[model samples]
Target: MPATAYDAKGLLKSAIRGDDPVIYYEHKRLYRWIKEDLPEEDFTVPIGRAAMRKEGSDITVVSYGLMYHRSLEAVSALEKEGISAELIDMRTLSPWDREIIFESVRKTSRVVLVQESSKTGGVMAEVSAAITEEMFDYLDAPVTRVCGLDVPAIPFAPPMEHFFLPNADKIARTVKKVLEY
Candidate 1:
């Protein structure tokens, strides 16, 4: 069965009440979502690890999941506009590589979180809050988030799906605004 908001709420309640480790399915998806390119002997890519896609002094694009691919494309487009962006793929969410993100934020001081979720109370909120709370002084611009508008995702129609997801154009625009701050 597909996950629902109710299910997530119940899971959280149970975990809190029980106070025990809960191996959530969300973790499994990231672990196996993309086929590992590393050697078989060293199969571990290390969950909670952050990998840098590009290095730049202008701005940093932080993203994960399918959004990670989209950010890379945006980086290419931004390059044509004479904007250099560094992309970081945060594979694991729970044990996210805060050190990597903090270091990059301290260096560039501009961050745009790209996530394919509702803009309201989404995972991007947590990231933005953390950055502001922990590395506020390092930032030159306000941390911005590029997320799908508050709407449900469509399964079949291309146009509807497009409307439900954050595209490269939206990301590029958000990045430009962040740079201006």
Candidate 2:
């Protein structure tokens, strides 16, 4: 069997065992299947925590994994438009940074969650639910999420991948829309 086939089997096995929350990051690069890069040796990356990337009073953008990088790019674009967006990168999802999100939402009263997964039953839904449950009273505008369309995996083509995935420009537009709301 090929390596790709073997990897597919391993993923299925892991999912069945439910040993760990498998982080399935899709490849954006067309015509390639890239594996996640872990440290060369066994090392510790503190999970279930968050890092503050920016400080601002206007609005906060919270995301994890790929969306974290996309959110940063969106914030950079927002800055060019005179809207300083504070970004919080949630390194882990299960034990997300509720304190950071809550405080930021309370202070700014506005938030936009940027994610790469499909919106339906995706991470963005959980984030929106958390904010509304915990900080609804503090919100000035409704919480919003910018996520990919609920479509199947992209084809091994550059144009197809670009169309299927959420890009920085799309994220920036979403943030701007939320700010206007």
Candidate 3:
């Protein structure tokens, strides 16, 4: 199974203890993240469960790994404009928590998926398709994706890399567009 983890501690522990073989993809950017709120005793986040980062009524934003960090920034900025975005960090991709994702979509009626991969194909596409397929009736607007540029590879130069990858402004803009629909 292919799994992803945003939290430095909780999800890592869960993956280590799971019986199934897992290909865990650790985001390099998240390696330095320090979580000060962990429990005093050992704990583990369930393998198939996603952690809800924030709750809102206007829209749902789904992402994982480093993209989750970027989406959080965009969601916070949107909040200042009075657009509420519910954020979900998909802790595991293969066995993603559909119940949480579907419930959020049902309440918000709109969703914006973000990923660091190119716009052509990725986990974002799969999740977006699943939402449309299973919760089509609940949606007020079509599911939207805010992903990286469709380039062969990310640019080596720092400046171009900024443009190639999914960032906060891009995500915020896409969320606003979906909200306007």
Candidate 4:
């Protein structure tokens, strides 16, 4: 499960109680950078459901993990510029919330998928393909992706890493590009 700080407690508890094996990922950078309040009582977030971060009509932005936060930044900027971009946070990859995603696509008719991984064989590839296959007629433009460069591995240097990974600016640019179509 790719969980946010707010969903950490609930997702962790859900993972522990589930029957199937699960791999929970926690971004080290997020530990100190993000904070959220949790319910006082125990709770669980369904493993297959996604969270809708924002709603809009112009376009849809789908992302996960750290990229989800970056996408939020891009969405906020686009809002300031009078572009309304709906944002979806895919909490789980294997069984992503296709209903929510497809619903957003039906409304916006355009989408940009963001990921920190390379463009090739990344999660976005499968997602884009699914959208094309299942919601092709609903689309007004081709699905776009804002992902890391196709280098074998991201560089360690801060400047190189920033250039290689998908950031807020990159995501916003891609979103705007898709919106134009």
In terms of TM-score, the best-performing candidate is 4
TM-score of model 3 vs. true structure: 0.92
lDDT of 4 by residue, 1-181 (tens): 4648767777778889999998887777677887787678767888888899999999999998888999999999999999999999998888889999999999999999988889999989999999999999999999999999999876999999888988999889988888877
lDDT values for all models: 0.75, 0.72, 0.84, 0.89
The best candidate in terms of lDDT: 4
Error of 2 at 69 (Å): 1.5
Against the true structure, what is each candidate's TM-score? 0.77, 0.74, 0.92, 0.97
True lDDT of residue 141, candidate 2: 91
> RMSD in angstroms, all models?
7.3, 6.8, 2.4, 1.0
Model 4 lDDT at residue 142: 96
What global local distance difference test value does model 2 have? 0.72
Task: Give the clashing residue pairs of candidate 3, or none.
Answer: none
Q: In what order do the candidates fall by lDDT, top score first?
A: 4, 3, 1, 2
Q: How many residue pairs clash in model 1?
A: 0
How does candidate 4 fare on TM-score? 0.97
If ranked by TM-score, best first, what sequence of candidates would result? 4, 3, 1, 2
